[model samples]
Target: MRPARGSPDTRSGVRWGMRLTLNIDASPLRRWHLLLIERLETISGLDLSISLPETDLPDQSGLGPLFRVEGLLHNLRSDGLFARASRAEVTVATDRPMDESDLVLDLGDGRASVPGRRWTLHVDGDAGEGALVAALLAGRMPLVELKEGGALIAAGRPGTEYGRILLATLDDVLSRVVTLIVSAVSGGRLRVPTLPPTEAEQAAAVPQAGIAQTVVKAGFSKAIELVYRSCFHAPHWRVGWRRLDGPDLFALKRHPDSGWTDLPDDGTRFYADPFPILHEGKLTLFVEDFVHATGKGIISAVEFGPDGPLGAPEPVFEQPGHLSYPFVFARDGEVWMIPESCSAGRVDLFRATAFPGGWVKEATLIEGVTASDATLVERDGLWWLFATVRDGGGSFSDALHLWSAPDFRGPWTAHPRNPVLIDIASARPAGQMVIRDGELLRPVQDCRQGYGKALGIARVTRLDGEGFAQEVETIIEAGGPLWPGRRLHSLNSAGGFEFIDGSAMVRRNPLARRKPAAVLASS
Candidate 1:
């Protein structure tokens, strides 16, 4: 029995709901804080109010110059940029006085211990300090928590954008906090997070870059990106495949020593998000065929023989807007596909009238969501759909949301505790789920280095109506003797064939005069 929203414990006088006071620093609030307040107001049973700390918070206006310099260099817009809490635009419910029974949410740097039921934000075990900024400067996405005293209410590993580190990370952090509150109010139990432990050696512990240093770094990064784009199609991806004779990537936790055979691509386009399946007793591979000329992705398929692919992938499905991820499976004796169409603002179901062609839209699984890589699995007589949602303008690769339905197609219900996880390293679904040794294993994208920078096989500890939890057992990076690509994006296997995808540098103009390996590799 989940609570729809947060109320005091049953023993409290107000049984149905309780008053909520958001305690913040006395300094002027920033745009994000105001945005957060507005969001909370939309939820029922929150009975929201605000209280300011007695003491003024330290001024953080000094970061203004650095932000401006970095913004100009990267052409960063103000949409999601972070400034300071030193300025105010609007005021929220500061008129009301807090009652003894009111639940206090401490969102201040002072970390005042409040009476009664209280919630506080902590970053890397530091309560309400400049921990967020410290983690960002150290080039890490720190573990964040919403705690009541020493008890962990909810925790998340927020992702950051190196280009717009401050703004993006702030958005992600706030999104996680909001998720925690929503879960508590909705009668969902906020349990201790089961996220994988991080090694201390992985922490960079780098000092914050100064304004000049930030500007220089941004400029240098932009210069290299420009050169790379000029010379090749940026973010070009290629599919890799090898027959699965032994344990697959999930079991091995590393690429096979024999390595993967590259699926050749013409210079005009690239392939990614490989999904291989066996239909009609024949092996077929589907991919996101991204054409450089049109700058859009279409679902393409190719039949594979015992040795390798029979030929190049042919366009099997196309939509009004860009489509990819082509999640295909056999249901009710008919082959169906749900390709990623987040640009079209919907997750669609397609039926292949013909084996590999003649596709028709059967249904719309979900709509009005910017969700990526819709993965479906049946467990305990329920169909569960997993995808990372881009909520209120944040990174697309974080904030994992879940939906469950009795049937795979229609009438899906959003999970009450949505975004059950928010770790950049293991939130986004890389491919379909697999069961091994009576344990359910999921392939998740590790975006800590960057989007699709690596792949992780996570063991799902708990997944149900209450909440979700997973422990990442292995993180596989793309390099060394087997897979030499810079990014290991997705993983899938079927019909004794294992498939993966990764970043590849392709010449923008195939006919251009050949350049030395050193010159080409420098970009």
Candidate 2:
């Protein structure tokens, strides 16, 4: 053991060079390392210089050698350059003489071998994906490991650029192969990581009177951010009252083809929700018009016109009861909608008697349950509705429930496996799903840390089975005042533009030059 020395005075990497044999205390941890390596390699475009031990170490349970690796990341801000003799390379030489004089990484794809001692790396996802191990081997890759608190385990020297990124803590080599293997073998199913259980820490009270809202640089671009003003008693939402006060216009972010600047203020305030549909010849938006009052509800309508919201919102229809989450779906020329009839304890539908407005109730799909934010998608001749129901608290609580109807208008059935997906953070629907290169991508509000605070993306790998198989990635977080006070996340699509509701936009994009609805006309 060459005394660990990568301090300011003397910079030396933890010298463990020899045919090294490493073991993950738990199998899942091994799998996790392999996955991160592959992903980071793909995303950062750097070939990793780390690898797991060649042989498997059964999960005997206990925080293995990884614990030490974790501690190093938290404590060391800079890994300092290596020995002046070799500043560019972080070499790992084995004590035992090896038959092959090469650096070999076993990613199970095969072993990625290079006729060299060390390799340079950056976090990337373009290392090419097949199986994590196989891809690594195919690419002759090493891994960057993830330890406690998602810290990286780097065993070599660090350059200035690498050091700055290490601010997010990229210390270890990644193993992208093993984790993907587990995912494939399990049919792409996802669950809370099966790591060793952790103790619950007492949550610090939501900070004192005025905790200055600080900026948090995120590794991913966030979709939503929220700021809890502790000035009033119990906050506004909890008291069931949200005021529609603003500049009274929604300055659009990710505005559409209409060349619109903002939504109208003629008493129409857009809520952070989006509905996507193929109406006539192009994709269209049916955004939320939320009325903030004692008996407030969301309006179901689309923004029309060539430029943008042509005018104040045109009247769509009035549900006798509260209505929100009015999602529009068009199939074979006829338009249909699934509005939040949660208060009525069911998901009901209506056919549009006219385009842009005028919808008549057609059928009641699911009955005898509570559901809000109901979004509908038709795949393989099956109508699937993604929605949230009451599991505990009355507000947006519990996992999202999936129900299917043979026809958009009929008695629907819930997926045999109810709560098809859980995790408040990624399970709740932020808006509508986007079809990118044939992939069904849903923008999810990650409430795991808190409600509507962080944003995640769930790519549905499988929805044919009893339940869905998804791959989730936390993609964004609220930065700070540069936008608004946080809480900006939702996926919206209208015409040719895919609108991402960010914190700064006050009103929906409603211009008439290109779109059908006039922003301030016919109010």
Candidate 3:
């Protein structure tokens, strides 16, 4: 049916809806610039066009020669590099004249006069080239901002590993740009959160580590890892437990003064992702039992007696793919679990027919998404699911997404604004969310140093149909008197006992170097 005279038509929005022009420098462009243009074209009610304005960018501190040699070496040795998406190549584009538009996305260095509204992009307050690279060389990702006539409209801190600085950081920054533009076109309120630390305060500029230095560092790191693996079952994790007689982590916002007791584990396998739940007046602790031999993980549970865990965690649920982060909770007189199964590309819900065992697949809450650590909570008569998604191509620990449902099981709907939070320090769920003094406190993974290097407790100030926001109040790291490890991964509490997990080193006996008799295959 044709629309009325004045009604908006999404099919023909190019004629009636807003027109957006992306202004770029006359010099060569990067792969991510084209990626941003491709994404804008997919929106329904907006028309996108390219503009090449005569401009020049600041020098990139001699990065052109450095990246050429670094990228080639990285491509040749595939195993040691950080998880990355694309190689940012400076390629040429055909010149095109600017079309009349309602909005201009100025990606150039200068803030020239434009036809309509102009939002200029800035990195760490510098609207010049090499800003991102300069920040990375100084040892951190840059804070990206969008400004209109020097007024801040939106800002975000883009994160990535230092090895693939150019490609990974660009991927995340462009991802945020899409979110900003889409919200504007859809009449949604723009999120103008407080800007993070300034570039000067964050770090001082340092020269890029030359190719020789990087090669030496990589070789030394690789050799140490090989030796560690040969001498021990490396990357082994262990859980810690203590009676919760005083304030919990949410209220305390720090590790308890009294040290935690270690949860015993056999040498064959290690346990992590501690989740303690109470059902029908019984307390049980569940973990991700990862067998070193099989190289797979399964959900396991153990009953807690008056003193401590009755025994080691026994396999309660097994799948064909790896699983972790067993987020078990009680609802509607039943116990349910949603484990991290991103390898399967879906989030599945399971109900416990028998208290801690006999878990059966109940429903698939979400599909076709590689979401990590799916955490579900009920608030204001609605169930909200939080997880970090690998949107487009970037780190899985940076882009957070949300879904809402009437119940915990079916008919889950994605939030209108996804990638609601794009911060590597506090995007991934570390454990369950808790309530303290009429406020919501969530445990999050701080992956700034490395994956699961520390834990952060954030206060959720705003969470509704409109959007989500949080303030990280505390960061708890490992290697203290209580917890001695390199990575503090997860935290949870129930039935008067609190639980946490971190990396532990377990040596393998050199005399018994042979493989185990039977490998526990996943079902």
Candidate 4:
């Protein structure tokens, strides 16, 4: 439907959607630019048009007549500037010498000359194609296949690892861009939210001489580690636990490094994502069991007593696709589970027909999404679901999204400010959302260094139908006597027992190499 043509409504406080004319520099237009236009077409309440200049370098002085049109103007090229005295409202500005590899986008309320939001993107692919591919995929924006160097590459099909990384980088920027644009159009404040700091920013913030030496040392150390792993060592993860009481829940002190017990695992498999649940006065510990042979994970459980695990963990649930992060909870006297099913391309909810076994798929809360570590909580007479979603193809540890429903079952509505938070240091769900002293606190995975390097405790400052916000209160790292690892990912509690998981080092079995037939047959 066409938007009504008028000024913003002062009485109703609803800004009338205006016709947008894109004054783009068509000379360097690429596949990504075309994809952006396709996305813009899908947005309602905006009539869009495009105007291209005949000359390579269009005269900026002559753009005044073009700006005098009936609606708002989007000057996508920085060279074209409106006269200071002009009365038209221009909302966008692109920096000069724009290339596919680097772009600076500035956004502002149409009424202002100074832009309040700015994003600088350094494309990481060949000639900026990687960044463009990322933007197209992350937004789910479509584009026709384009030929390059005798090969046809589709918009969504990023064929290389570098391409995928580029896509993730672009996706991150695009997610923030959409947020800022939607907020501005809705007459909200033009303040930009915090996002993951760029690599350059992180480097510049550190001492250059020290950083250089550290980088060189780290590179050499990593090379040696890689060699050692290839010859004798293998990476492993193990679960750890400590008993807790009511008072311990509030002022929980870290157990001594020697006091924590390690969950047993076969040399061939590793255990992670520990979730403890108390059911009918019995405590059961659930975890993700990943086997090296299949390179996929399955859900496993072990009975936990006052001392420790009663026996070894047994398979509780297995799917054709990989599953991990067994987020289990009790509601209405029934047990429900929502494991990490990103590999299956959905957020599936399963109910136990009989205790831990006979688990059946009850419903799919979300489909066609790559979501991780879904956590749920009921508050304010509403049930809110939180998870970190991968937009197209990017880092799965950033971009937190929320959905709410009157009940845990059907008709879940997405939060208006979707992707409410996007920061690598604190966006991914790490564990169960808990209420401390009547205030809600969320456990987030801090992936700034790498996946699950630490845990962050964030307090939800504001949450409603209109918007969402949070403040990270504490960061828990993985370097103590009890739990010593390079990565600490999951945290959960039940039945006065708190569980966590972290990376561990394991030696490869020398006999495995000697018995090649046995290894192959077992696999």
Q: Residue 331 CA error for candidate 2 (Å)?
A: 1.3
Global Cα lDDT for candidate 3: 0.71
Q: Kindly list the per-residue Cα lDDT of model 1 for residues 66-88, writing each as its tens digit.
A: 56655675676644524445334
Could you give me the TM-score of model 2 versus the true structure? 0.47
In order, candidate lDDTs are 0.74, 0.42, 0.71, 0.58
Kindly state the number of residue pairs that clash in model 1. 7
Residue 267 local lDDT, model 1: 63
The residue-by-residue lDDT of candidate 3 on 205-246, one tens digit each, is 456575456445555655676787897786788888999889
lDDT of 4 by residue, 334-430 (tens): 9999999897788989998887767998899988788989999999899999997776644676667889989887578887656665556667888
TM-score, each model? 0.89, 0.47, 0.83, 0.68
Error of 2 at 495 (Å): 1.5
Q: How many angstroms is residue 62 displaced in model 1 relative to the true structure, after the best TM-score fit? A: 2.9
Top model number, lDDT: 1
Rank all candidate structures by their TM-score, best first, as comma-separated numbers: 1, 3, 4, 2
Candidate 2 segments whose C-alpha is farther than 4 A from its true place: 1-190, 193-270, 276-278, 281-284, 293-295, 300-302, 392-395, 479-482, 502-523
User: Which residue ranges in model 4 land beyond 4 Å of their true spot?
Assistant: 1-3, 7-35, 47-235, 245-259, 510-523
**In candidate 1, which residue pairs clash?**
3-186, 3-187, 4-185, 4-186, 5-185, 5-186, 6-185
Cα lDDT, model 4, residue 506? 57
